[model samples]
Target: MAKDELGYDRIVERQLRGVAREVLLQVGSKGLPGDHHFYITFRTDYPGVSIGPTLKAQFPKEITIVLQHQFWGLEVTDEAFAVTLSFSGKHERLHVPFDALVSFTDPSVKFGLQFELKNQQVELQPADKPAPGAAKDEAPTALPKKSETKPAETNGGGDAKPATIIALDNFRKKH
Candidate 1:
């Protein structure tokens, strides 16, 4: 077996993360063009992640956020991005680094990207670190209290939730 270059994997990882960041910035700044929304999953414990106490508590390891009609105040930097999203009617800001992202999916187009952590980077922590000023077992306190009134019913049914359908296609055939 041939030995690969030591830094090649790191370089590739960096570039992939950059692509994720760029795509996020574009969608965030311009809004979803046409019928496009993203389901982004990231490691809550990654460095530079700043989330509310309630969110941390609910999603202690990982969380997937939807970028649909309710997110606001998106700002993207070279290394990370910050945005405010409403959860249970309470608005909370989140700061997530590109390195923390594990998956990015556009359900409208059924397009997605999944990443594998490069084990070579031993200095970085896994996706279970507590945010600054947070205790080891601190639960997120930002989640809104449950409302008494039920949400409006759609024409589909009486308050039942809609299902998400995803289609997978394989262009190559193996025998």
Candidate 2:
């Protein structure tokens, strides 16, 4: 197979993430059917993400918000989406671009989608806490440097793993 010279993975990731946005807009415009619900996790610091100060204080890094029963004014546009949700008896509107989403899951049918943020957008942070004996000045290991080689194929493989599609019946049976 000839080596690729283009960044296809990033393009595919962008497309897949757009699918999530379209699906959310569909469900939000038309009410959710049956027990289907969404748990969306996104980066709080992503550009175009607007949340109330209280919510920002509570979820300084990332937040997983549920879209089930309590939301209103759902609007979707070419670049971003805005929704009004109530918190602590006060309603707050949040505007999030499709690029900000990190993970989305519809647990009713075990369906999920994950995304990789652009290199410039991803935060460099340690996962595990330092050990008791670890030096304070020690830095967390950096991610492996990405190669400049092009992708071998447009699609990774003809038999690439399928995106998770939740069976409607599975959600129906749950409730």
C-alpha lDDT values of all predictions: 0.61, 0.62
lDDT string, candidate 2, 62-81, tens digits: 66666777778888886778
- Top lDDT hit: 2
User: Cα lDDT for residue 101, model 1?
Assistant: 71
Which window of ten consecutive residues has the lowest lDDT sum in model 2? 137-146
Q: Candidate 1 on 30-70: residue-level lDDT in tens?
A: 87788777767776767678999877776775776777677
* Residues forming the 10-long window of minimal summed lDDT in candidate 1: 164-173
Best by TM-score: 2
Give the Å error, residue 74, model 1: 0.9
Evaluated against the true structure, the overall lDDT of model 2 is: 0.62
